[model samples]
Target: MTSRRSFLKTSAVLGTGLLMAPNLYARNKKYIGVQLYTVRDAMAKDPVGTLAKVAKVGFNTVEGATYTGTQKFYGMDPEQFKQVLDDNGLKMPSGHYMLGDGMPNAKGTIANEWQKAVDDAAAVGMKYMVCAYLLDGERGSLDHYKETAHKLDLAGDICKKAGIQLCYHNHDFEFKQENGKFPYEILLNSTDKDLVKMEMDIYWIYKAKQDPIALFNQNPGRFPLWHVKDMDKTPKQMFTEVGNGVIPFKDIFKHAKKAGLEYFFNEQDICPGDPFNSITQSYSYIKKNLV
Candidate 1:
């Protein structure tokens, strides 16, 4: 029954199928991550249980939000925390840290005992440590921003020694014009590019009426991480599930390679109902639509 014509056609079809298989496998290989801040309450109550639930919901990575208060990851020391993450089959490649002023007396902050924090992060196998936020008291003038940029570079040097990258997470405030110049611009220009990279918060950039694409074009390969939270279409512009909001995530994700994006975390600062439900919804939408 093996005619030459039929066998040749069958071979061509099989070759086509084989060619398409690699693309499907590559698509499945993209990592999906979540910010633990989305489940703050549950983490506060029971971090291990919360992480288990997060893994059950199909998130392979998590970004930490709390550290300064206790100098620990989710109320556990670095070793214990890493074990919990391994137990749940999760990886934490990045975590948030406050600038020295936010909690002045904190032991493991960037300003106080930075070496210890960096060491702990290395112990946890983290590849990146982020300067989480700047308080109003901490940010005032361009001079202050320059000083902060210098500090970031210094912190970054410590991170570099540990084989970890240092990044800055931004809010809309950095875009505000102070002395006829954007502090964010100062931060980008003042720091050593290799030492201090950016964690572009897509939601906040949009909220500030800035274009993420433009930023990517301006500073190629400088943004190594992203906070992939979305904003609602309402006038209030509240946080919403990833695809449920108006952000063009598909378009944004298309430029991931150009932006040097290694990892991105879905974060919703506030949720309407159960936070786990919100995170699950976001994870589903992101997995279906964006990488």
Candidate 2:
């Protein structure tokens, strides 16, 4: 398999624009964003500088990944973070927030911190607050997933009241079967469609051997956000920059309308070098090919 860097070099030689013609325009002109988690280290060091680099790479929007514990976004207050984004010509329409340790009591009331998270998200002008992951203790049986779904609905209600939407971001584990049923299915069926939407990580969906288009067909308009990463062609299937791997993104982008895609972000969890380079390569490919 070609290394992502090498593939990018080769594509440049092939004349990227000429090779990737007939591109589909993005439904939302600012749909191309980068999930900041892709550069967590840099963000931790200097969020302002990192965001400037992100803007320089041609990203107009960003999805934040660091809003846990700090009660602030990337070590700054909500207003400060918003100003940083504005200075860099960027907007954050969505952000990842962990459903904290406490579960809803028997009365189905969530913790105060969760409500605070919703409030903070709204203050930052974010339209979506994504339940980014589920801990090991949070998963096991179908009933556990159903319970989580109930919590998601409660959280979604809070977010809806705050004028923000709540979404769930899935990993491959959600697709694993427990007692002949996928937890993903439980979450989808158990949650109220209007309250809880989904953010599809296309790479993980492929890793789980599932078809994104099939899911879109089954649950039309449920996925409004997507994490666009590619899997290396090798059996190990390591994460690679978009368009440098075997995943057929062009085919996937063709179904954006059916999937109700409002925003898509490039997110490579692990990169070979500077994360910005990985994002830039993905951005170039998306602009010239997938849109």
Candidate 3:
């Protein structure tokens, strides 16, 4: 029998013709954004100035990565941050938040502070609030993931009432197996489809040796957000600028419709040089080739 990777490679090739049709390629006009975490240092120093630079670099949207203890966005209140984004012609459709640790108290319901995070995200004109990461302690067995899924569903209901959606962003750890089962699969199976969605990080999934196309095929329309980072060709597979790497982004993007991709952000966890320059490089490549 063929391996899953082999099957995906063959399917990707066979599906190319269908994805290349005029109607399909036309959908590439959706807004391209950058995850602000790429410029964390600059944002911490000066969010207003950083946002201005992001707009100047031709990014139409951004995904925020700073929202912790203070319950504020980049040192500014939600209203103030929204204004900064608007002034620079940028919009934040989604933002990352921690949902496991302090979010829920002993009662298993969302704490007041977590509710504030949800409210602030909506106030800032965000359409999605993503639970961005799962700490090591939070991941032990499949049961833990199932409990997390339940918590996510509850959080999703809170977001729904505020006219926003709640999603989960993945790194490579979710792909690790425990007792012959994948935690990623457990989360997908346990969570209600309407309640919790996924933000697929292409680079990490590739690093984990998983087939994105296969996941998309298995759970069509479940992935609404994508982190479009690239992997270096080196043995370590370090993160690299989009077009300078080995990932087949153009081919993967051809299946955006099936993936339910609403917005995609360029995110490089570590930049070799200036983050702004790195993001500009990725932006230029996407504009010239992928988009």
How many steric clashes between backbone atoms does each model show? 0, 0, 0
lDDT of 1 by residue, 83-172 (tens): 999999999999999888667788778899999999999999999999989989889898999999999999999999999999999999
Candidate 2 local lDDT, 96-185, one digit each (tens) = 877664443311123447777777788789999898888787787889788888989998998899998889999999877666567887
TM-score of every prediction relative to native: 0.89, 0.87, 0.88
Q: Give the TM-score of candidate 3.
A: 0.88
lDDT scores in order: 0.84, 0.81, 0.82
Off by over 4 Å in 3: 1-28, 102-112
Rank the models by lDDT, top first.
1, 3, 2
Residue 156, candidate 1: Cα error in Å is 0.3
Q: By how many angstroms RMSD does model 1 differ from the true structure?
A: 13.0
Residue 144 C-alpha lDDT in model 1? 91
The true-versus-predicted C-alpha distance at residue 37 of model 3, in Å, is 0.4
Runs of candidate 2 with Cα error greater than 4 angstroms are: 1-26, 102-112
- Which candidate's TM-score is highest? 1
Off by over 4 Å in 1: 1-29
Pick the winner on lDDT between candidates 2 and 3: 3
> After TM-score superposition, what is the CA distance of residue 196 in candidate 2 from its true location, in Å?
0.3
lDDT of 2: 0.81
